[model samples]
Target: MLTERKHTLILIILLVSLPVFALLHLNSGQIDLGIGTMIDSMFSFNNENMNEVIAREIRIPRMLTALLVGGSLSIGGLLMQTLFRNPLAGPYVLGINSGSSLFVAFTIMTGVTFFQSDLGMIINALIGAFLFGLLILFFAGMVRNQISLLLVGIMLGSFTSAFISILETMSHAEELKVYMLWSLGSLQKVEFHQLGIISLIVFLGLIGALLISKQLNLLVLGEREAKSLGLNIKRIRYLIIGITALLTGVITAFCGPIAFVGLAVPNMVRILFKTQHHIVLITASFLLGAIFVMSVDAILQLLESWMVIPINAITSIIGAPIVVIIVFRRLR
Candidate 1:
């Protein structure tokens, strides 16, 4: 009862602070837009007014992208960690992001004009993520040891990286520049028009995750124990991978290869909540993850006048230290 109460209080605080941070985030961009203007733009878009246009077209989509990507990556990390029983597991650890990067690199570097479009990029990314997810699943079936499966995933990522590097060497300067810009990661790429599709996909993926919360709780007990409890381990594995792929793929398609949001956020939630219940973990992960990314982007916005920084760089700078601490704690 005490722990639940504590959790409830923390969640309430997070829920309240989310809007506060969101409002601040909306206002943090280069141009100063008042709260009244931003709210009005949300309800009544005015294209002629530059402030309204910036609020509706630029700031709103960026904030929403941060929220969706942050939450999705956190959930993906949680699912991967639970599925593999590894503290360090994440969405990109299984080479899903690498697969997306490879496909996008090929498409862009090869001068494929049709596939260079936004829609084409999304389709190719989804295809790459789905295929790589299946490949990891195949390897998971073959490997009894979870650590071995992780090794397979790392090797796959390394292989893809090598291929991408080779493609970069042969590509023209313009194409290479485009791919490099994408690999750096950013929340600004999403537009208001694209949010509908992105939101729908994220909503479906979150729902899928919630539906499997029970199975995830069982999986935390171990595969044999879960199977003994009448859980179909194979089916659960498929579901987790499918959802992770869907979330990770779409985020990568839009935001580029963001690092550590997946690996770091769930671990943070686990430490704070101190629970094995997926329902609590998932909800907390979503809220906390959204705040985490939004905070990072807000910092970028504050610093925009002085220096330009990639979103990926900022995340890595913050997430790497957390990862090191996790490693040290595990060693202890």
Candidate 2:
């Protein structure tokens, strides 16, 4: 358990580190712009210089995507855990990622650039996640076994991946390259231009999470207790599903299926903060989640001396262990 002072200090540390890491992300990648150069590009627009363009236009968008996706997914994880009353529950665990990935494959392989804009990708991802995510919920009701339900979700993901693979086989090289990169997951795809829509949608999700915080607290007491206290568990569950789908779909559409942060960050925050209050958990999750991901991304930049590791790969490397531990705990 953390002392109140320690909790305050941790929050302060996270708040301080987030901007520091964001700045590091802005300056640390391949081109290696100095902080002065990075700041100048932000304060003074420059169209001519390659360094400025890379600093202001390229890296900033990637940083924003990292921050937004990490934060949104972490909150989504927290929401899923609270709604399902299952510590191991997460957006990716529920087939949302695979569903979004499947539709994205369709868009890339079919050569339909019609809705290829950021808005279009979000729409595609939202539809895909909602369909499969809702299906998982429906199945959860039928299968009383949580582990079996999780297995079913995994099978759903595998089914979607098989479909994605079929699409890949039929796709031309150029199309395959596009689809492949999307599968690998990169912050590089998002430009500053796409930030507006991403920000609006993610902000909406965060707002929804905030509105439900109290209800979530009630839920932590258990469904029967919550119902006795006049809480509508069914309505809250639907709302959480909608919010989780929106956040997961938008982030996956833009950033691909960067995994683990959602599953890991919420657990880490709970361990560190030692509280389930949605007020504390949600805020801490966002701050630490953004910092955790930006730090991973920074490590990826620093590691450019060796190989350009994919964001998803690095995240899985770090998150997989924590997830395994959580599973053991769940089983225990």
> Per-residue lDDT of 98-188 in model 2, one digit per residue for the tens?
8888888887788877756666788988888778777877887788666777788789999998888888889898988987878887888
Residue-by-residue lDDT tens digits, candidate 1, 1-332: 99999999988988898888888898889888888888889897788999898888889889999999899999988988898887777877678888888888887899988888777887788778878877887887798765577688899899998999999999999999999988888899899889998888888889999999999999999888999999999899889988888888889988899998988999999999999989889888888999999999999999999998888888888887876786677667
Choose the strongest candidate by lDDT.
1
lDDT of 2 at 96: 76
Q: Please give the lDDT score for candidate 1.
A: 0.87
Q: What does the lDDT read for residue 197 in candidate 1?
A: 86
> In order, how many clashes per candidate?
0, 0
Worst 10 residues of 2 by lDDT: 112-121
- Lowest lDDT 10-residue stretch of candidate 1: 141-150
Assess candidate 2 and give its TM-score to the true structure.
0.93
Clash pairs detected, candidate 1 = none
TM-score of each: 0.92, 0.93
In model 1, the Cα lDDT at residue 30 comes to 86
